[model samples]
Target: MIAPPSPVPDSKISLWTPFTFSLFRAIWIASLVSNIGTWMQNVAGVWLVTILTTSTLLVALMQTATSLPSFLLSVPAGALADLTDRRRMLLFTQGFMACMATLLGTLTLMGNISALGVLSFTFLLGMGAALNGPVWQTITPELIPRPVLPFALTLNGVSINVARAVGPAIGGVIISYFSPGYVFLLNGVSFLGTWIVIYSWKRKVAVSSVPAENFIGALRAGVRYVQYSPAIYAILIRAFSFSFGASAMWALLSIVVARRLQLDSSAYGVMLSWLGAGAVSGAFTTGIINRRFTVNQRVLIAIVIFTGTNLSLAFFPAAYWLYPVMFLSGMAWLMIMTSFNTTVQLNLPKWVQARVLSIYMLVFQGGMALGSVTWGTLADHFSLWIALVAAAVWLLLSAFLAIPFPISPAENLNLTPAEHWPEPTVQGDIDPDDGPVVVMVEYMVKVADIPAFRQAVDQLVRLRLRDGALRAGVFTDVTNPSRITEFFYVATWGEHQRQHHRFTKEDLAIETRVIHFHTGSVPPRVTHYIAFPKAPNVDIAPPFENMEGQS
Candidate 1:
């Protein structure tokens, strides 16, 4: 008799526990500093653009420039992260960003910076961030143990918000006393801290026996994985919706503070601090909140609350009242984002983790970019109040999406590879690069069991496709009602071998269930066929006989 599965370690992680791990602490602190610098740079960049041009469209485009690169490059970056050393990749990107910031700062100090120059620098900085994002996320699992990973992720978000809370206020004072150029210079210096941390990290890289996938192939696989995963799709949709609406607040808040409230840079910075304060509070209490509500419930509630905050900001003229509204906005932001991010992190397997996360990032950052442009134009043509109200309405309508696509808990998903498939028996030397390969499994069942068998095979189709099958289908014999054939095609023989390595414990369980339904005296018959275009005279035939006990 088989034993029951082992229980997952209870993850009663506290806010400070993750910091106990020395490496995690080092990187976390470094990352926090870097995030503060980034926010400071953001405040300076937008303010600089505003000073150069009063056009709302151009001011909002600064936001777009900072996010659009993620949409364009995240997938490729993710693939690269998976293919190469994540640490080195981050080092390169961070160094490049530091150089770009320094150049922009130098130009600004020389009074040579223009509106176009600021946008260009922002885009370049975003490109670095876009490439760095997936690598950064994928490396988190390597930094600490699994039980405390949730806390680490939560702390990471909190760190960003902490920086957001502090950076803008510091930036405002500096810009007031010194200039925006000094802010840029500080941002440039901050990148070195992260770079030094990464460089000093002695990461042990895992070496794989199988050849690494080509960039294009890896990208395609990542996209296919996302397409087949319902959980990821739901998360991405929610991310897009929430980000598209929330972006109006981020893109237009400076304009609102300056023009509507007639506030100086100092007040504007303090207002942003309130939003960050709310986020910090939300992060700290997220564990308690999650315990009280389901993911769907929490997400919906957060959306409604955030919408209320936006509406309050639009209609209410008093700046003091807006402080609380901004605070609520920040809280709602953390609740929704943390929910989506934690869900994705738990659901993904290590093999495809970076690639899948890149897609999620793409949707999230893309929505912000698109929304910034849309809301900025709306504000230019109509009014800031109208744009804010319209965005809130869009956010409220987003709640209905929860009905069709509910978020599922991923605690039970065993993503560890089972490695149960036996190595194929081969007749002769077969090239790894050999042409398209076909895999077929034959099953014989009682007439009554056919329906159940078909249902099982239908479920297996998605697994087959997700694991690397280019195409998969189930077929029934015309001569015998008891016979069923399941087949899938792969691009190359090497890919078929990769698929063998991709099966998980859950997949093995499913395969066992299908096998139990088979009525054949032996186990299901399995065969593999490889195409050979060079030898037209050769007839490739099945190499194996009936295997009764093998599954």
Candidate 2:
């Protein structure tokens, strides 16, 4: 069994402890500034669309344009993050967004901007954000020690919410007193801080014996890993459900303030600020909540609270009531999102973290994009109240999903690399890009242990596939009733080598269980075979004699 991580001193485990690390602190501060600018830009963009068009669909479409890129590009971006230099990728994406924001601000100031123009720029900015997200997340582990990683994640959330709390009110004030163009321009300038911080970071490059996978290979491997991981799938499902329902308020808040509450831009900003305030409160308290509740319980409570808030927002017309309701909504938002993110992180090994996270990002954003349009169309056709009520109903139903797909904490799982697999014995030189490689592991099992052995090997098949096996199965010897051979295929010798690196301590435990069932005198005997084309007349021969080994 894998041992638990060493205990962090209680004094260093508090909410603010992540700031003790210099790099994390620097990056956090810079990111906070950038996130504030982003929130400001969001406020300006949404408000601008509302002003330029009377169509609720068009206004909602603004959110769709921004979120759609995350759905389309997150997986590829995640693959890139895993396969390339993450810091440099972040710098490029940030710079690209800054340019997009600047161009948007310029056009708006020059009186050359239209609804379509705003959406085009918003889409471009979204693309940059999508590309930057996985890289940014992957870098966090490099910045802070494991003892404080959870706190660092929470701190990241807090920074965003803190920006949300401040940016909207400030953006609203600027829009009211000066112009929306100024808010956009400020956002454009804000990216410079993040760029500088990323550039200044002297990040250490990881040295690996094997080269990184090609883009397509990385993408496929990531997908395969997630497919076999039930924990990740559950998290994705919950995230999508929550995001779909929660998107209503986010996508239509400006319109809701304008049409339902009869409020000005400044008032709308205050509403958003209150929501952010609730989020901040939730972030600060998450550590305590996590200690008290299970993952499933936390998610359930958050959903119920958020649903109530949505229903209240739908029925209550008073402006003052929105403040308390939105505050509650913010709290629920934090609880749900933080739980989902932490659960996913805990379950994943470093090898596939970014790729799986990208999938999570895709589902979350895709749900929001689709939900925005649905709610907007409902609002346009019927009323805002009906739209919100419908969304609230859906959220209420989503709470039941947790029953079948319960969220489990990953503390018990040993995800650290085991590095226990012995290197394959090779008799001759083999190209790294050689043809498909087949491996056979022979086990001598008594008749009484065959059923148990089969079950154990079945589990091994999944692990093998998750770690890059192309195909896997078990076979019985025709002449020897007690001989069982477990076999698997990999596209290349290089992939089989990579699989050795992917094995975790938990996987090692499983391997131990399988080995106990083997009744062989020594251990399971392993053999490797590489396929080659048949010559015109000559028979291809096996490379080595006694081609047997052990793992």
Taking the candidates one at a time, how many backbone clashes does each contain?
A: 0, 0
List residue ranges in candidate 2 displaced over 4 A: 1-7, 10-12, 45-61, 103-118, 175-182, 251-267, 376-389, 478-481, 534-551
Worst 10 residues of 2 by lDDT: 1-10
Would you give me the overall lDDT of model 2? 0.84
Off by over 4 Å in 1: 1-12, 46-61, 106-119, 179-181, 252-267, 375-386, 534-551
lDDT of candidates 1 onward, in order: 0.84, 0.84
Per-residue lDDT tens digits of candidate 1, residues 369-487? 78888988999999999998998999999889888888887756787888888877876766777759989999888889888888888878888998889999988899998898899
TM-score of each: 0.88, 0.88
Judging by TM-score against the true structure, name the best candidate. Answer: 1
What RMSD, rounded to one decimal, does every model reach?
Answer: 6.6, 5.9
State how far residue 454 of model 2 sits from its true place (Å): 2.8
**Structure candidate 1, residue pairs in collision:** none
